[model samples]
Target: MGKPTGFMEYKREKTKEQPPLERILNWNEYASRLSDESLQTQGARCMDCATPFCHMGIEVRGAAAGCPIQNVIPEWNDLVYKGKWQEALQRLHMTNNFPEFTGRVCPAPCEGSCTLGINEPSVAIKSIERSIIDKGFENNWIVPRIPSHRTGKKIAIVGSGPAGLAAADQLNQKGHSVTVYERADRPGGLLMYGIPNMKLEKEVVERRVNLLQQEGIDFVLNTEVGVDITGEQLKNEYDAVILCVGAQKQRALHIEGSESEGVHLAMDYLTGVTQSLLDSKFKDGKALNVKGKDVIVIGGGDTGADCVATAIRQEARSVYQFGKHPELPKVRTDETPWPQDPNVYKLDYAYEEVAAVKGRDPREYCIQTKKIVKDKNGRVKELHTIQMEKVLGEDGFYYFKELPGTEKIWPAQYVFVAIGFEGVENKIADHFGVNLVRNRIQASIKDFATNVPGVFVAGDARRGQSLVVWAIKEGRAVAASVEEFLTTSVKA
Candidate 1:
């Protein structure tokens, strides 16, 4: 509520991005920050309505509608609108442990639910949030607040993603000795590897991890639970264990020639490229080379887009992406009215990059792959696909019906399946005797406690594939539950 009429005075101004052509040439973040003055103006647009839905961390249409962590949106916006940046940063950090990560990667559901969005463009809350945290870092306002006292209780976290990290941060604040175990050579889980470098640079991930280490959180990398160490060992050694292992098991394609040499999983391919970039800067060699080859990416979600962008950067001859769903409307429809997550079409960075370099958008809607054509040497050579139309079935649901005579083939030397994940891998949960329903650990959200006492779950491990914001929320909530469990046990 900085200005009563601020919404009328300022139009929403989005952060600028480097041109696709120039940005595609490098693996750096392309989005540019707005000037401090411009951001303040954007902050002014926060109507700060009496019933603000921006901070209502609740479910809408079976999905998160606002900030999952319930960030103090209006208060911070008012702080920024008046140039009280230090106060804004402090308020922002009160709930969110990692604003920097969400500010870059989150889809900003807060904007969709903004009061002004009913008629006008919503406030640029995400960009303003990014600016607040980035300024805090630039001014060295972010430092480890070491706990003044230590609790003898010890805890073990099974993953090092956002959920695990947030839990560690929160539990450490309670003076508990916390150690996070990551199976990968590095922590941050998908944040470090699943996401491409251009969207969220690895350096940013490293900086946060280093800060966590400096704050006295112990990290045990290259150590996986249920493999390197038994689940019984963890239960015997630590007072409590929290599992935050993310949903990483990628959905697989089951068409013919699926085992061809040139076909690969999207994460496996993306991970290899990133590891190579970090190790040798892609000079010596690459883990999976797509140079001069026609690349076809299946699944048209963000991961599919990342595959397209990565192939373009690898200098692929051409790229194509297939989506099983029909093309989304350019504007929000009645099916997804205002205040709901908009199901609209807008060019993402990778789509923009492909269109710029190839002179055409490489996406096809209502398409399904029929077969993966392979060369004589068993490498993927092309893809056969067919167009589909939605037909109402007797079950009262629309099903994709293949349109005959619409089959086509395209040259594709490399194929990457970018379909979404199924659920959490079962090994760790099984080892710990935790029940899993639908590949997610069976833990009550009310307490975040599993069937096994002293065992808990959070993030994708408990909720399936979800946004980073929700993961952080789950982490913080689980930390509180762990604290309560520890206190009750000590009293007994």
Candidate 2:
């Protein structure tokens, strides 16, 4: 425990963002760091509960209830509170491979389950975590641990996302050589591109990747398996293969006029913007510009928020985000009680920018895109939408019925569809002769073995779209299973 009565004495505080007007001019991270003294005070709030449900890592009704990676929350929190950050970093790495990413992006389920949260504001577990890793870097304490012994096995990890990276890290530490393959020019998977720059700086990703490289992990980039390299070649070369490819198949609008020029899928548009930034070119050459366009962002999850933020920075004349659900409550709602991810509302950075520039928040709740109206030249000119929403049934059962009699049109020169993703593309899975259950590649929780020998599945490719924490957890678990299979060699 950090401090005996720390929880009672302290109030929750968080990092602040730069002024919206100033932040919108470019793509740079906005959140300011909590000072060292403040962070220590926040860390002392950990109650050190007897049960510590925060790290139990259990599934409650098919949703994560605690930290998926079962992070040693109390131990690290206490260490940070005591200002022993080097030891804290050691404690953190025992479970998680990348606190930096999770620190930036994870929704922080651990805080929700915190004992302090039973009635009051929880300990700033996430902020404490971020500080620990930052200290690790500042002190140059993070270093590669080359395994002392060798299992004489090789593992090939497909996709360099968090899952794949986690798997490789664990397997390598267990004395097996691992290689990660990425299709993109640079690695990091979704972290490299799907997420915008203003939230997570690219330099943060590269610094960690450089560490991985120094650790002797081989990265083969600009290579697409099932295209550049055959699946059979991979099976013959490595003792085991793991797929951490995420769910990237973006869901589309079946509504009319979707095929028009300016109507683009969210991922496709995001990818283009990111790629252009990385490549330093746009359609006009030199500077990639979405400037002066009236952008309409569809869907209301984090991706939608990201799209809104990205467009604002690109100098869009106006931006509107259409969410099918009604506005979330300002406080936790009855439907989502304690320990569930709170559906409470706080304006994300993007929404804040939209408000600063446009005189109001850009979100239009309970609105569904009816159709995309196009100009004579086949470019999107406007969007037709319906203001309808789904509500729970009063009869104590599951219900999702749409409300009626709400439709309107808004001028939109560019449309970015930010609906969520489906499972990974099945072509490679089918090509490898692995069986898929439902949409994802099937593997029991006991072990990540796929239908084919020497093949395993983990992360979003196996579990469908999910959090990065879950991906890392699955990766570590799967790595152990693959290690056992190769080491035992039919011992059973």
Candidate 3:
């Protein structure tokens, strides 16, 4: 929509990062920003399709596709192309509340479903998005949007993650008095704790939160709803309550010797290290210093990769990651095709960092940790492992089969379990008396309303543990339901 021939004039490109070797030395963001000139060119390649599937956000193959919050992709791309950065920022804020987090971390499926991607590489939507907001901040365009008057309606949000933030942002825009409660010392939920600052600088999170505070929204930190305040009290105090408490329970290892010291959850390890780095406080000497220690991370998901990279930064003597499944292919498979999440091998920042520091990938596929062994001091000494085959278990659940005589032991000073999460925690669910279908809060993706009339759930709590983008989507969707409920109540 910028220049008629803009698509033809530009080629798909993005900002390159500081080499992994150089980036691992500091706990800062790795990717370098695209220059203003290059950003304009990339944005111009948006193509402006009549039917922009990039923002359509479909449910193809029973799984969601495209942008979840329904980001106005093409419109903003065109604005950036025309050098209207401030205007682009306005258009972006029409839906998403935190482009800073998503632009950096989101796996841009919006680009995948782009019509342009059917033939050529999709527009650099994520990069363009980051540029617009960055430019807005530089020009002093991002300021608090205080509502002219209050509606006298009070609302309580149960979490401070992206979903909670999005719902609070929208509800505040409706002139409702909004308060967000977080159990953590700092808000931003997992963004402030679970994710490493090296990947996403903490100041970025603070910058947005500061702006929110200036906008008159109240944030009550270190107070959990179920603990500090009862669910019934919240319902009584506020006109409505939105539950954004994310999945906090981690899927754990079932192997023998699980109680051994030096074995910890992946989230626990990352949280301790990041908190220590922030407060300059270490555990006795240092926060899980892996220097000169051999490490084995026991999962293949994003958390596992994060452990691998974090271990390298701690200067571990050696690190190895075990994956239960077989190695993925380099290209998309039949089960996951174009426009769908590709079931392929891709190096995340942590894996890339580990490979850069250690001179190898450090990942072993089709292997499972059978048991852990501890030394006389009760610290983990080694891991017994073997390759496994895919088969049905006696319990009727499919599991990996260990081949006989394939057992091997490797010295391991530390073992971090990076497996995925279960559903929302049972304590809070039981306390609220909310029912769950499959560990997830019982609610449709379209409407996150629980059986309780005034209660709503969102984010990883509603969709199981998922990407940040999906959290935003669920938050916005739940906002619609909340708004409708509020309007109906007012009329009655």
| Highest TM-score against the true fold, candidate | 1
- Root-mean-square deviation per candidate: 1.3, 2.1, 2.7
Check candidate 3 and list the clashing pairs.
none
Clashes of each: 0, 0, 0
lDDT of 3 by residue, 91-170 (tens): 99887889999888787888767777766777788888877877788889998998888888888998999999988888
User: Which runs in model 2 stand beyond 4 Å of their true positions?
Assistant: 281-288, 392-405, 490-492
lDDT of 1 by residue, 298-352 (tens): 9999889999999998899999999999888877789777667766788888989
TM-score (C-alpha, index-matched) for candidate 2:
0.95
After superposing candidate 1 on the true structure, give the runs of residues whose Cα lies further than 4 Å from its correct spot: 490-492
Q: Give the best candidate by lDDT.
A: 1
Candidates sorted by lDDT, descending order?
1, 2, 3
Ranking by TM-score: 1, 2, 3
Report model 3's TM-score to 2 decimal places.
0.93
Pull out the clashing pairs in model 2: none
- How well does model 2 score by local distance difference test? 0.84
